[model samples]
Target: MTSLTDLSKLDDILALDLPAPDAGAIEAARARQNDLTKPPGSLGRLEDLAAFMAGWQGTDRPTIDRAQALVFAGNHGVCAQGVNPFPQAVTALMVANFEAGGAAINQLARTAGADMTVVPLDLDQPTADFTTGPAMTGAECLDAFLKGAQAVDSTANIVILGEMGIGNSTVSAALAHAICGGTAEDWVGRGTGSDEDGRARKADVVARGVEQHGHLSPLEILAALGGREQAAICGAVVAARLARIPVLLDGYICTAAVAPLHGANPAFLDHCLIGHQSAEPGHARLCGAMEKQPILHLGMALGEGTGAALALGVLRGALACHNDMATFAEAGIG
Candidate 1:
């Protein structure tokens, strides 16, 4: 796929012919599942997950030899609205922690045996405050989007996407509300341990952002209400799809970041899976709206792809059972 040079060219990318999962591989995997020593359907979602991976990998036996996790960090000017208790500097500080391998995500990625990459999108220049106008200009949003798309490793069998941005929960709420069409309260959630009052303020800010932007195309909503990290997530999702790499989506912020793409085209998420259900209330509702059932529900809301990284272990287990287990004939059973 050619690199995206302009935001106007995004429509072309969305309209490009995308590959579908291999039906033959899916059938072969299902047959193997039935022939396994275990009783039919006993493994439940594991069985389905194995088939899903097989279909994407185009093989009855698939392995995740290399998995890539991307965490995009950006500062949000929306923090000026008092939506977050933490200062904006926290974003840069946390990025430093990620690089130093001290953050939770670093440990999680290491445990999952996935290579992690952190991309900080102009941390010194936050997106414009959306309550007053568009969060980012076309050029700024396009640049961040390209940064995300370029970060994907084409050799990875699977990709996990996440984001880090102070006051980004409000940006997420605004994006979700603009794309999903509900009261701002439906999308706002206490992020970074916001109290009730802070959540209320977030909701108010989201409401104002949506009102200011009004109804628009999904991409337009992204440019209007999304921050740099949010746009990067969207870009990464598209790049992964183009490369035929299955994706594991992280919690609320990550999900909301790509919600606009789903709004533009539901098929955009066909190769994607929700890693977990976030404790943030809006995430479940957003998942329902997107028709995605999460793989795990540990009540995790921490971003940075932590939940997705943990869920990678689940995928690895599914592949292990699918590829290593003996068939009933081989076991001389049944």
Candidate 2:
């Protein structure tokens, strides 16, 4: 794992100004949104979803267009509380599945012409090939999030973030409570299909974690439960914002992972889209706090970017229509 302390090296990169999305292009896309095949205002929020993506990417051609899914995998210290049904080993095992291209995220990334980048964060026993364990410390987490941001900038112009870990929900709830200032009961949820007993345990664990770490700042909260994957993903989002690359976020854990950075950089919200409303209790609160509209409401609790992967399809279709549709003048129908 890369020591979180090395982040000081990236101070220059983090300070660089990012290019802005074109407002003129966004205005044009908004005009085009009303001109789609459907009646005016008929497609509901999706019309807005597509137009915003197009405008932000500066292309009526906005397509989740070159979508990529980066799965941040790690293990949490809180899982010992019986919060997760799967063993901690599953984080490493499934990462192997992700690398082998057999996981759902792999299939979706393939379908969307999106690359799947597997980032292994600091965990007890990390499988090889994931990014070095995240830099430790809140400063480290911030620096690592910036570094992850730089990695995503290298390839995908637009991206998605997913996570894999046995007890990430526990960490996520704690992070949510810390950053958003809510109770553990408000943020905790069943992760990896926990039973009633497991859910109770998950909530209880998060409550304890919150109370223990509640005094810390956002970065401190991350250092406490910010698994390697969570920290890297947070850094990646910072990098994405710095690069101004649009990011589609998966369920609550992945979204919550970036909280510290979000607090540091509120502009981070302008560069992201929340892909789904997770069944997790705290997800809605987080989304509301971010003011992002989740396109899919599948009650999903699966963290492997399955929800984001699915939502990207709808976003892609919206882009296609915006860029390819023949206007009345072009078709000579008027």
lDDT tens string, model 2, 187-222?
A: 877677778787777777776666666676566666
What lDDT does candidate 2 reach at residue 125?
Answer: 51
Cα lDDT, all candidates: 0.90, 0.71
Q: Tens-digit lDDT track for model 1 on 36-130? A: 99998999999999999998989999899999999999998888899989999999999999999999999999999999999999999998899
Best by TM-score: 1
Poorest lDDT segment (10 consecutive residues) of candidate 1: 1-10
What TM-score fits each model?
A: 0.97, 0.86
